[model samples]
Target: MIKKEWILQKALEQFNERGYSEVGVRELARMLEISPGNLSYHFSKKEDILIALLEQFSARNSSFYEHYLTLSPTNAHFLELMEKIFNSQYEYRGVYIGNQYVRTELQSQDRFDYQSIATKRASTFQKIFQGLDAAGQLRVNGEDIAFLVAHITLFGRFWISEATLFTKFPDKNKTIRHYLFLLAKQLSLFATEQGKKSIEEFSRGMS
Candidate 1:
């Protein structure tokens, strides 16, 4: 029997190394040293493979949210969670870099709902912002909190793509750390004095 997990692992590596559209089933099969028919036995189409990959992404994101829900309302907790979230995103860089294209293909296949994913992300971030506001870490009022949540969500979604434009150095770990630092800096700008101190202390510890 074909091992689905092995196909996924190899596919993820290929997707990350080469652009998704550039890697066809034949190319993937050749890379894996398996016949295209063997891959087809497990995944009837490329969309099938992509859907499987997206399912893994969904599960990982759900796990992140579950752990995030357990965090105490503090700037330090938030920064730490930001680090985890960004690191996870970097692992799935293919998703961010070609999100629209992936979603479009998945939608065309009637196998994915991008809007639901987007809605869930918005709701999750809003809750995080609400927790921060309740803890007095956020200086913004309720109205601004909504915008701030959306702002951060947008940044997280597109940060990898943005990094690509100027990240000529190509150190993946350093890029992830830089983005996390940027996230903390953005939040610090809208933080209360106590929150700012917490963030500063967190930064010092990292350095």
Candidate 2:
């Protein structure tokens, strides 16, 4: 039973590392040192495994966002929250990458299930933005709208896979950081003049 759990966990990691289509269920069973029948016993199909992984991802990310929102508004909090966007992208990179490994997994799955997952994942983000808005720290339109803005903040950096990203520095981590800095700089302007002045004063002191 413990070995079975380890195999399941590795399957999730392998799905991410190599993508879903390339990683055959039979091979996964082999790697797990188990019969295909056993894996099928727990998860009837590969699509079933993908759905379970997505569900776990959704719950984990939602809980994380909820915890982050409980923190008071601060530039650091804002930055951390934005970093989460990349982290999420990396976790689900294959979903966005097309005509390849990730695309195959998506095609094998139910479209309605994918749509529902997207909607549910989006709500956690909306709540986090709403928290910031309630504290008068955000300059965005509304929580729902703001969620879209925040998500789009990383548009240039995301990839279905590294191949889809730029060649010079395929890693999007640096690009994501640049966006986070830009976001905090622009959003900090929402503070009162005195608050803004204090920020300037701090910059001067640092200089």
Candidate whose lDDT is highest: 1
- TM-score for candidate 1, residues paired by index: 0.91
TM-score of 2: 0.65
Clashing residue pairs in all predictions, respectively, total: 0, 1
- Residue runs of model 2 more than 4 Å from their true location after superposition: 2-5, 92-112, 120-136, 140-207
Q: Write the per-residue lDDT of candidate 1 for residues 1-207, one digit (tens) a residue.
A: 669999998897877666577789998899889999999999987778888888887778778878878978878877877777777777776654245667567767667776788789888888888888788888777888788878877887788777666542357777877887888888988899989988888888766
Instruction: State the number of backbone clashes in model 1.
Output: 0
Error of 1 at 70 (Å): 1.0
Model 2 lDDT tens row, 164-197: 4444234566555555555556656554444444
lDDT of each: 0.78, 0.58
Worst 10 residues of 2 by lDDT: 152-161
| Cα-lDDT of candidate 1 | 0.78
User: What lDDT, from 0 to 1, does candidate 2 have?
Assistant: 0.58
- Lowest lDDT sum, 10 consecutive residues, model 1, at 94-103
Candidate 1: residue 118 lDDT (0-100) = 79
